[model samples]
Target: MFQNRHNLSERQVEILVGNLLRYGVLFSSALVLLGGVLYLIYHGKETPNYQIFRGEPPAFRSPEGVATSALSGRRRGIIQLGLLLLIATPVARVAFSLLAFMRQRDITYIILTLIVLTGLIISFIAG
Candidate 1:
């Protein structure tokens, strides 16, 4: 007679391959999600209604038969959330990666942290 005993060895994997899989998933998904956030920010930045430097509002009749600001409340709401996500994601990613590195002393965490931190700094400075 045999029992369905738990075999810890069955679940164990080679360390390097395991680490590679983990870091691959983390960085790949992070980059993919970051791309989406960047797209949102880019589109928000390009929208005519979101442009802050437009000196003259176009002459257009409102529903009340008067000129209305292109800076509509709905546009502001979308733009605000887009910009916040664009700015927040990378910052949070770097902070969490740094903390992970501190806890585990992993080089993968260090590398990812450096890349994200540099990206965030360059973004604010160049942007």
Candidate 2:
């Protein structure tokens, strides 16, 4: 029984590592994308909108002074990080289970993928 289990463990590890590679791709990509977005937001160009709001409430003209650009950028950054986490977690789980699937050559990937897809779809619809 022990012998059989170890063989299973080794195969499972390989498949799991493969799946981790997928999530690693997503996170690294998201970081790169977010970085580009931040750069554009900060230094892309000037428009009429910016000029219009230049001396408005967000520019210390209002009662509750707030720097709209800075506040919005900070909030966007936090939301992006949260999005990264939401995507990365289950991908990690699927990666872990992939190890078991490789060892057993079973239906783990199919089930894991379906679960991921379902969650993603639900998120999209609800949001």
TM-score of each: 0.35, 0.33
* Tens-digit lDDT string for candidate 1 (1-127): 5533233322332343355456655654554455456556767566465655654223321222111221342333333334444445546646655765655567886787888788887886676
Candidate 1 RMSD to the correct structure: 13.2
Best by TM-score: 1
RMSD of each: 13.2, 11.9
lDDT of each: 0.50, 0.56
Residue lDDT tens for model 2, 4-70: 8767776667666666766666775675477557767775795446535343233433212323433
Find the number of clashing residue pairs for candidate 1: 0
Best by lDDT: 2
Q: Give the per-residue Cα lDDT of candidate 2 at 58.
A: 34
lDDT of 2: 0.56
Model 1 pairs whose backbones collide: none
